[model samples]
Target: MGSDNTDRNKPGIANFAALKTAIVNGEDQLVRELLSHEPMLDIEKSYLIDLAQLNKNHTIIKLLENISVKK
Candidate 1:
């Protein structure tokens, strides 16, 4: 795991990049892992939803929707 101080200073763009790569690569496990590690990483305004739509990944969309509902 990254150091707490380092992780806190990490830019949100880095998290967005990782999330985009994970979604595009169809690495659902990686997506979950990234989300788990960066629970504070914001996804609502990211391109993740657009990627899921472009790829017709209904499962991911549903998962995102479920998460949004919970929040």
Candidate 2:
């Protein structure tokens, strides 16, 4: 039996949680990597922005803003 694993490989809560951690920790590269692979919803983006703001992460905030604007 053959089955595609693409769906299984899709980012889920763990990725989201990791994104949150990356944002809070000011890990730009990790954040970029996660964002590149995961399609975040508007609510998720907003929440990430809020988290970035809380941490005063201008870099992450700008990154999120740029991506949000592009999409």
Best by TM-score: 2
Task: Give lDDT per model, in order.
Answer: 0.63, 0.80
What is the per-residue lDDT of model 1 for residues 14-62, given as tens digits with 9 covering 90 to 100? 8667877877787777776666422342444345677878888777665
Top candidate by lDDT: 2
Q: Which residue pairs come into collision in candidate 2? A: none
The segments of candidate 2 whose C-alpha lies over 4 angstroms from its true place after superposition are 1-10, 37-39, 69-71
| Superposition TM-score, candidate 2 onto the true structure | 0.72
User: For residues 1-71, could you state the per-residue lDDT of candidate 2 as single tens digits?
Assistant: 13346556455767888989999889999988887643557877788999999999899998887664225
Error of 2 at 23 (Å): 0.8
Q: What TM-score, over all chains together, does every model reach?
A: 0.58, 0.72
Off by over 4 Å in 1: 1-11, 36-46, 69-71
